[model samples]
Target: MTAFFFALVASFLAATGARDQLLVAGLRARLGPAPGLLVVALASAVATAFLASWFGAQLSQGMSRDASTMFVALAMLLAAFECIWPNRTPRPQEPTRSLGAIAIVLFLRQLTDASRFLVAAFAVALASPTLAGLGGAIGGGAAVAIGWAAGDALESKVPLRKLRLGLGLILAVLAVWVGLTARGLIG
Candidate 1:
Protein backbone atom coordinates (compact mmCIF):
# COMPACT_ATOMS: atom_id res chain seq x y z
CA MET A 1 0.00 0.00 0.00
CA THR A 2 2.79 2.36 0.93
CA ALA A 3 4.66 1.64 -2.25
CA PHE A 4 1.54 2.07 -4.28
CA PHE A 5 0.78 5.35 -2.59
CA PHE A 6 4.26 6.64 -3.28
CA ALA A 7 4.11 5.57 -6.90
CA LEU A 8 0.68 7.13 -7.36
CA VAL A 9 1.77 10.45 -5.87
CA ALA A 10 5.07 10.52 -7.73
CA SER A 11 3.48 9.69 -11.04
CA PHE A 12 0.74 12.26 -10.54
CA LEU A 13 3.25 14.98 -9.73
CA ALA A 14 5.38 14.09 -12.71
CA ALA A 15 2.43 14.08 -15.09
CA THR A 16 0.95 17.31 -13.71
CA GLY A 17 4.24 19.15 -13.93
CA ALA A 18 4.77 17.98 -17.47
CA ARG A 19 1.42 19.30 -18.73
CA ASP A 20 0.61 22.23 -16.45
CA GLN A 21 1.91 24.94 -18.71
CA LEU A 22 -0.01 23.92 -21.78
CA LEU A 23 -3.17 23.39 -19.79
CA VAL A 24 -2.89 26.77 -18.18
CA ALA A 25 -2.30 28.43 -21.50
CA GLY A 26 -5.36 26.84 -22.99
CA LEU A 27 -7.50 27.75 -20.03
CA ARG A 28 -6.29 31.29 -20.01
CA ALA A 29 -6.98 31.68 -23.68
CA ARG A 30 -10.38 30.09 -23.65
CA LEU A 31 -11.86 31.03 -20.30
CA GLY A 32 -9.93 34.19 -19.42
CA PRO A 33 -10.33 34.60 -15.68
CA ALA A 34 -9.43 32.94 -12.38
CA PRO A 35 -12.98 31.76 -11.52
CA GLY A 36 -13.70 30.29 -14.91
CA LEU A 37 -10.25 28.76 -14.94
CA LEU A 38 -10.93 27.09 -11.62
CA VAL A 39 -14.19 25.62 -12.85
CA VAL A 40 -12.50 24.16 -15.88
CA ALA A 41 -9.67 22.78 -13.83
CA LEU A 42 -11.99 21.12 -11.35
CA ALA A 43 -14.09 19.65 -14.10
CA SER A 44 -10.98 18.34 -15.80
CA ALA A 45 -9.76 16.66 -12.64
CA VAL A 46 -13.06 14.95 -11.96
CA ALA A 47 -13.43 13.75 -15.50
CA THR A 48 -9.86 12.50 -15.68
CA ALA A 49 -10.13 10.66 -12.42
CA PHE A 50 -13.27 8.87 -13.52
CA LEU A 51 -12.00 8.02 -16.97
CA ALA A 52 -8.55 7.00 -15.84
CA SER A 53 -9.84 4.81 -13.07
CA TRP A 54 -12.22 3.01 -15.38
CA PHE A 55 -9.61 2.43 -18.06
CA GLY A 56 -6.68 1.89 -15.80
CA ALA A 57 -8.26 -1.14 -14.22
CA GLN A 58 -8.92 -2.74 -17.55
CA LEU A 59 -5.39 -2.01 -18.82
CA SER A 60 -3.64 -3.13 -15.66
CA GLN A 61 -5.18 -6.57 -15.86
CA GLY A 62 -3.13 -7.39 -18.93
CA MET A 63 -0.30 -4.89 -18.78
CA SER A 64 3.34 -5.97 -18.98
CA ARG A 65 6.53 -4.08 -18.34
CA ASP A 66 7.48 -3.95 -21.99
CA ALA A 67 4.06 -2.71 -23.00
CA SER A 68 4.03 -0.12 -20.28
CA THR A 69 7.44 1.15 -21.33
CA MET A 70 6.39 1.38 -24.93
CA PHE A 71 3.24 3.27 -24.03
CA VAL A 72 5.18 5.69 -21.90
CA ALA A 73 7.73 6.26 -24.63
CA LEU A 74 5.05 6.91 -27.18
CA ALA A 75 3.33 9.33 -24.86
CA MET A 76 6.56 11.20 -24.21
CA LEU A 77 7.36 11.45 -27.88
CA LEU A 78 3.87 12.70 -28.61
CA ALA A 79 4.10 15.30 -25.85
CA ALA A 80 7.43 16.47 -27.23
CA PHE A 81 5.94 16.82 -30.64
CA GLU A 82 3.04 18.83 -29.28
CA CYS A 83 5.35 21.17 -27.41
CA ILE A 84 7.76 21.62 -30.32
CA TRP A 85 5.17 21.77 -33.06
CA PRO A 86 2.01 22.95 -31.44
CA ASN A 87 -1.05 23.57 -33.58
CA ARG A 88 -1.05 27.34 -33.89
CA THR A 89 -4.61 27.71 -35.10
CA PRO A 90 -6.83 29.31 -32.56
CA ARG A 91 -9.30 27.08 -30.76
CA PRO A 92 -12.61 26.79 -32.57
CA GLN A 93 -15.00 29.20 -31.02
CA GLU A 94 -17.73 27.42 -29.14
CA PRO A 95 -21.20 28.78 -29.81
CA THR A 96 -22.10 28.49 -26.19
CA ARG A 97 -19.92 28.48 -23.10
CA SER A 98 -22.48 26.55 -21.16
CA LEU A 99 -21.76 24.32 -18.18
CA GLY A 100 -22.01 21.30 -20.42
CA ALA A 101 -19.52 22.79 -22.83
CA ILE A 102 -17.15 23.52 -20.02
CA ALA A 103 -17.44 19.94 -18.87
CA ILE A 104 -16.78 18.61 -22.31
CA VAL A 105 -13.77 20.85 -22.81
CA LEU A 106 -12.28 19.90 -19.47
CA PHE A 107 -12.83 16.22 -20.04
CA LEU A 108 -11.34 16.35 -23.49
CA ARG A 109 -8.28 18.23 -22.32
CA GLN A 110 -7.62 15.68 -19.58
CA LEU A 111 -8.29 12.80 -21.91
CA THR A 112 -5.50 14.06 -24.14
CA ASP A 113 -3.11 14.53 -21.25
CA ALA A 114 -0.84 11.45 -21.18
CA SER A 115 0.22 11.95 -17.62
CA ARG A 116 -3.28 11.27 -16.38
CA PHE A 117 -3.20 7.91 -18.09
CA LEU A 118 0.21 7.10 -16.70
CA VAL A 119 -0.86 7.95 -13.20
CA ALA A 120 -3.98 5.85 -13.62
CA ALA A 121 -1.95 2.89 -14.79
CA PHE A 122 0.38 3.23 -11.84
CA ALA A 123 -2.51 3.43 -9.42
CA VAL A 124 -4.21 0.41 -10.88
CA ALA A 125 -1.03 -1.60 -10.74
CA LEU A 126 -0.29 -0.67 -7.18
CA ALA A 127 -3.70 -1.42 -5.74
CA SER A 128 -6.97 -3.25 -6.31
CA PRO A 129 -9.51 -2.01 -8.79
CA THR A 130 -11.42 -0.17 -6.10
CA LEU A 131 -8.36 1.44 -4.64
CA ALA A 132 -7.09 2.29 -8.08
CA GLY A 133 -10.31 4.08 -8.90
CA LEU A 134 -10.29 6.00 -5.67
CA GLY A 135 -6.65 6.87 -5.94
CA GLY A 136 -7.03 8.11 -9.47
CA ALA A 137 -9.97 10.29 -8.53
CA ILE A 138 -8.12 11.70 -5.56
CA GLY A 139 -4.90 12.25 -7.43
CA GLY A 140 -6.52 13.67 -10.53
CA GLY A 141 -8.74 16.02 -8.58
CA ALA A 142 -5.86 17.30 -6.50
CA ALA A 143 -3.58 17.72 -9.47
CA VAL A 144 -6.16 19.63 -11.48
CA ALA A 145 -6.91 21.96 -8.61
CA ILE A 146 -3.26 22.62 -8.02
CA GLY A 147 -2.54 23.08 -11.70
CA TRP A 148 -5.47 25.47 -12.04
CA ALA A 149 -4.37 27.61 -9.12
CA ALA A 150 -0.79 27.67 -10.32
CA GLY A 151 -1.84 28.38 -13.86
CA ASP A 152 -4.17 31.19 -12.88
CA ALA A 153 -1.55 32.83 -10.69
CA LEU A 154 1.36 32.45 -13.09
CA GLU A 155 -0.41 32.86 -16.41
CA SER A 156 0.73 36.45 -16.78
CA LYS A 157 3.91 36.19 -14.78
CA VAL A 158 5.66 33.34 -16.58
CA PRO A 159 6.73 33.27 -20.18
CA LEU A 160 5.51 30.48 -22.45
CA ARG A 161 9.04 29.58 -23.53
CA LYS A 162 10.11 28.81 -19.99
CA LEU A 163 7.01 26.76 -19.36
CA ARG A 164 7.61 24.72 -22.47
CA LEU A 165 11.19 24.08 -21.50
CA GLY A 166 10.14 22.93 -18.07
CA LEU A 167 7.42 20.69 -19.49
CA GLY A 168 9.86 19.20 -21.96
CA LEU A 169 12.36 18.46 -19.24
CA ILE A 170 9.74 16.79 -17.07
CA LEU A 171 8.49 14.67 -19.95
CA ALA A 172 12.05 13.62 -20.72
CA VAL A 173 12.60 12.63 -17.12
CA LEU A 174 9.34 10.67 -17.00
CA ALA A 175 10.26 8.88 -20.19
CA VAL A 176 13.60 7.89 -18.69
CA TRP A 177 11.96 6.76 -15.50
CA VAL A 178 9.45 4.64 -17.37
CA GLY A 179 12.23 3.13 -19.45
CA LEU A 180 14.29 2.31 -16.40
CA THR A 181 11.38 0.71 -14.63
CA ALA A 182 10.58 -1.36 -17.67
CA ARG A 183 14.20 -2.48 -17.90
CA GLY A 184 14.21 -3.49 -14.25
CA LEU A 185 16.62 -0.75 -13.25
CA ILE A 186 14.19 0.34 -10.59
CA GLY A 187 11.57 -1.47 -8.56
Candidate 2:
Protein backbone atom coordinates (compact mmCIF):
# COMPACT_ATOMS: atom_id res chain seq x y z
CA MET A 1 0.00 0.00 0.00
CA THR A 2 2.77 2.41 0.89
CA ALA A 3 4.64 1.55 -2.26
CA PHE A 4 1.52 2.12 -4.36
CA PHE A 5 0.87 5.55 -2.91
CA PHE A 6 4.54 6.43 -3.08
CA ALA A 7 4.80 5.57 -6.75
CA LEU A 8 1.57 7.36 -7.65
CA VAL A 9 2.52 10.60 -5.98
CA ALA A 10 6.15 10.40 -7.02
CA SER A 11 5.23 10.01 -10.66
CA PHE A 12 2.67 12.81 -10.60
CA LEU A 13 4.93 15.24 -8.79
CA ALA A 14 7.97 14.32 -10.85
CA ALA A 15 6.13 14.73 -14.14
CA THR A 16 4.82 18.08 -13.01
CA GLY A 17 8.08 19.12 -11.40
CA ALA A 18 8.18 22.91 -11.70
CA ARG A 19 11.86 23.15 -12.61
CA ASP A 20 11.63 20.38 -15.19
CA GLN A 21 8.88 21.99 -17.26
CA LEU A 22 11.00 24.98 -18.22
CA LEU A 23 13.89 22.72 -19.22
CA VAL A 24 11.63 20.39 -21.14
CA ALA A 25 9.91 23.28 -22.83
CA GLY A 26 13.22 24.78 -23.75
CA LEU A 27 14.50 21.48 -25.10
CA ARG A 28 11.35 20.97 -27.11
CA ALA A 29 11.79 24.35 -28.70
CA ARG A 30 15.48 23.95 -29.31
CA LEU A 31 15.57 20.33 -30.39
CA GLY A 32 12.12 19.67 -31.80
CA PRO A 33 11.31 16.26 -30.25
CA ALA A 34 14.78 14.90 -30.59
CA PRO A 35 15.07 11.26 -29.51
CA GLY A 36 18.37 11.89 -27.79
CA LEU A 37 16.81 14.41 -25.45
CA LEU A 38 14.04 11.98 -24.47
CA VAL A 39 16.55 9.19 -23.90
CA VAL A 40 18.63 11.42 -21.67
CA ALA A 41 15.59 12.46 -19.68
CA LEU A 42 14.59 8.82 -19.13
CA ALA A 43 18.09 7.83 -18.07
CA SER A 44 18.27 10.76 -15.69
CA ALA A 45 15.00 9.73 -14.10
CA VAL A 46 16.28 6.22 -13.43
CA ALA A 47 19.53 7.44 -11.94
CA THR A 48 17.84 10.11 -9.87
CA ALA A 49 15.30 7.73 -8.36
CA PHE A 50 17.95 5.09 -7.66
CA LEU A 51 20.18 7.45 -5.74
CA ALA A 52 17.37 9.19 -3.92
CA SER A 53 15.79 5.94 -2.79
CA TRP A 54 19.08 4.42 -1.69
CA PHE A 55 19.85 7.49 0.35
CA GLY A 56 16.43 7.34 1.94
CA ALA A 57 16.85 3.67 2.78
CA GLN A 58 20.14 4.39 4.45
CA LEU A 59 18.57 7.18 6.47
CA SER A 60 15.90 4.78 7.62
CA GLN A 61 18.46 2.78 9.58
CA GLY A 62 17.62 2.66 13.32
CA MET A 63 14.62 4.92 12.77
CA SER A 64 11.50 3.89 14.65
CA ARG A 65 8.13 3.78 12.93
CA ASP A 66 6.86 6.79 14.85
CA ALA A 67 9.98 8.73 14.03
CA SER A 68 9.74 7.76 10.39
CA THR A 69 6.11 8.80 10.34
CA MET A 70 6.98 12.12 11.86
CA PHE A 71 9.65 12.68 9.26
CA VAL A 72 7.30 11.80 6.41
CA ALA A 73 4.61 14.09 7.81
CA LEU A 74 7.12 16.87 7.99
CA ALA A 75 8.26 16.26 4.42
CA MET A 76 4.69 16.22 3.16
CA LEU A 77 4.10 19.49 4.94
CA LEU A 78 7.19 20.93 3.28
CA ALA A 79 5.99 19.75 -0.09
CA ALA A 80 2.62 21.37 0.59
CA PHE A 81 4.39 24.56 1.57
CA GLU A 82 6.27 24.45 -1.71
CA CYS A 83 2.97 24.19 -3.55
CA ILE A 84 1.40 27.03 -1.57
CA TRP A 85 4.32 29.42 -1.82
CA PRO A 86 4.93 31.31 -4.99
CA ASN A 87 8.01 30.20 -6.89
CA ARG A 88 11.22 31.74 -5.65
CA THR A 89 14.45 32.68 -7.45
CA PRO A 90 17.44 30.41 -7.41
CA ARG A 91 20.28 31.63 -5.23
CA PRO A 92 23.06 33.28 -7.20
CA GLN A 93 24.73 30.52 -9.10
CA GLU A 94 27.99 29.22 -7.80
CA PRO A 95 30.10 27.90 -10.67
CA THR A 96 28.84 24.43 -9.70
CA ARG A 97 25.43 25.25 -11.13
CA SER A 98 26.71 25.57 -14.67
CA LEU A 99 26.90 21.89 -15.60
CA GLY A 100 26.47 20.80 -19.20
CA ALA A 101 24.33 18.02 -20.74
CA ILE A 102 20.59 17.61 -20.32
CA ALA A 103 20.92 14.23 -18.57
CA ILE A 104 23.37 15.46 -15.97
CA VAL A 105 21.37 18.61 -15.33
CA LEU A 106 18.19 16.63 -14.87
CA PHE A 107 19.93 14.17 -12.53
CA LEU A 108 21.38 16.97 -10.44
CA ARG A 109 18.07 18.81 -10.30
CA GLN A 110 16.39 15.76 -8.70
CA LEU A 111 18.85 15.94 -5.83
CA THR A 112 16.95 18.81 -4.20
CA ASP A 113 13.41 17.93 -5.22
CA ALA A 114 10.52 17.77 -2.76
CA SER A 115 9.23 14.86 -4.78
CA ARG A 116 12.39 12.89 -4.01
CA PHE A 117 11.90 13.56 -0.32
CA LEU A 118 8.43 12.12 -0.55
CA VAL A 119 9.84 9.00 -2.20
CA ALA A 120 12.42 8.64 0.51
CA ALA A 121 9.85 9.12 3.23
CA PHE A 122 7.46 6.65 1.71
CA ALA A 123 10.22 4.10 1.26
CA VAL A 124 11.26 4.37 4.89
CA ALA A 125 7.66 4.29 6.03
CA LEU A 126 7.07 1.03 4.17
CA ALA A 127 10.49 -0.36 4.95
CA SER A 128 11.01 -0.81 1.26
CA PRO A 129 12.98 2.19 0.17
CA THR A 130 14.75 0.43 -2.68
CA LEU A 131 11.51 -0.99 -4.02
CA ALA A 132 9.92 2.41 -3.74
CA GLY A 133 12.82 3.78 -5.71
CA LEU A 134 12.22 1.30 -8.47
CA GLY A 135 8.62 2.42 -8.70
CA GLY A 136 9.71 6.04 -8.59
CA ALA A 137 12.15 5.51 -11.41
CA ILE A 138 9.41 4.06 -13.57
CA GLY A 139 7.05 6.88 -12.68
CA GLY A 140 9.65 9.55 -13.32
CA GLY A 141 10.43 8.16 -16.73
CA ALA A 142 6.78 7.98 -17.68
CA ALA A 143 6.12 11.53 -16.49
CA VAL A 144 8.95 13.07 -18.48
CA ALA A 145 7.97 11.15 -21.56
CA ILE A 146 4.34 12.21 -21.41
CA GLY A 147 5.13 15.80 -20.49
CA TRP A 148 7.70 16.06 -23.23
CA ALA A 149 5.19 14.79 -25.75
CA ALA A 150 2.83 17.56 -24.71
CA GLY A 151 5.41 20.27 -24.19
CA ASP A 152 4.31 22.26 -27.21
CA ALA A 153 0.82 23.06 -25.92
CA LEU A 154 1.59 22.60 -22.24
CA GLU A 155 1.45 26.29 -21.39
CA SER A 156 -1.77 27.15 -23.17
CA LYS A 157 -3.62 23.96 -22.32
CA VAL A 158 -2.39 22.78 -18.94
CA PRO A 159 -4.12 24.30 -15.93
CA LEU A 160 -1.16 24.35 -13.57
CA ARG A 161 -2.82 26.22 -10.71
CA LYS A 162 -5.61 23.68 -10.45
CA LEU A 163 -3.22 20.75 -10.72
CA ARG A 164 -0.98 22.10 -8.01
CA LEU A 165 -3.96 22.70 -5.78
CA GLY A 166 -5.19 19.17 -6.29
CA LEU A 167 -1.80 17.53 -5.73
CA GLY A 168 -1.17 19.68 -2.67
CA LEU A 169 -4.48 18.66 -1.19
CA ILE A 170 -3.60 15.01 -1.66
CA LEU A 171 -0.21 15.45 -0.02
CA ALA A 172 -1.85 17.21 2.88
CA VAL A 173 -4.22 14.31 3.30
CA LEU A 174 -1.35 11.85 3.22
CA ALA A 175 0.38 13.80 5.94
CA VAL A 176 -2.70 13.52 8.08
CA TRP A 177 -2.95 9.84 7.35
CA VAL A 178 0.63 9.23 8.34
CA GLY A 179 0.10 11.15 11.54
CA LEU A 180 -3.00 9.18 12.36
CA THR A 181 -1.30 5.87 11.72
CA ALA A 182 1.63 6.89 13.83
CA ARG A 183 -0.66 7.76 16.70
CA GLY A 184 -2.44 4.41 16.37
CA LEU A 185 -5.62 6.07 15.24
CA ILE A 186 -5.67 4.16 11.98
CA GLY A 187 -4.49 0.88 10.51
Error of 2 at 158 (Å): 1.4
Q: Return the TM-score for each candidate structure.
A: 0.61, 0.80
Q: What is the C-alpha RMSD of each candidate to the true structure, in Å?
A: 4.7, 4.1
Clashes of each: 0, 0
Error of 2 at 5 (Å): 5.6
User: What is the C-alpha lDDT profile of model 1 across 74-175, one tens digit per residue?
Assistant: 556555444444335443454244656756766776675644555555545553545554555566666666555564454456554565556666766766
The per-residue C-alpha lDDT of model 2 at residue 133 equals: 84
Q: Provide the overall lDDT of each model, using Cα atoms, as 2-decimal numbers.
A: 0.56, 0.69
Those runs of model 1 whose alpha carbons end farther than 4 Å from true positions after fitting are: 1-40, 69-95, 124-153, 159-161, 180-187
Residue 175, candidate 2: alpha-carbon lDDT: 82
Cα lDDT tens digits, model 2, 127-148, are 8877788887877777777657
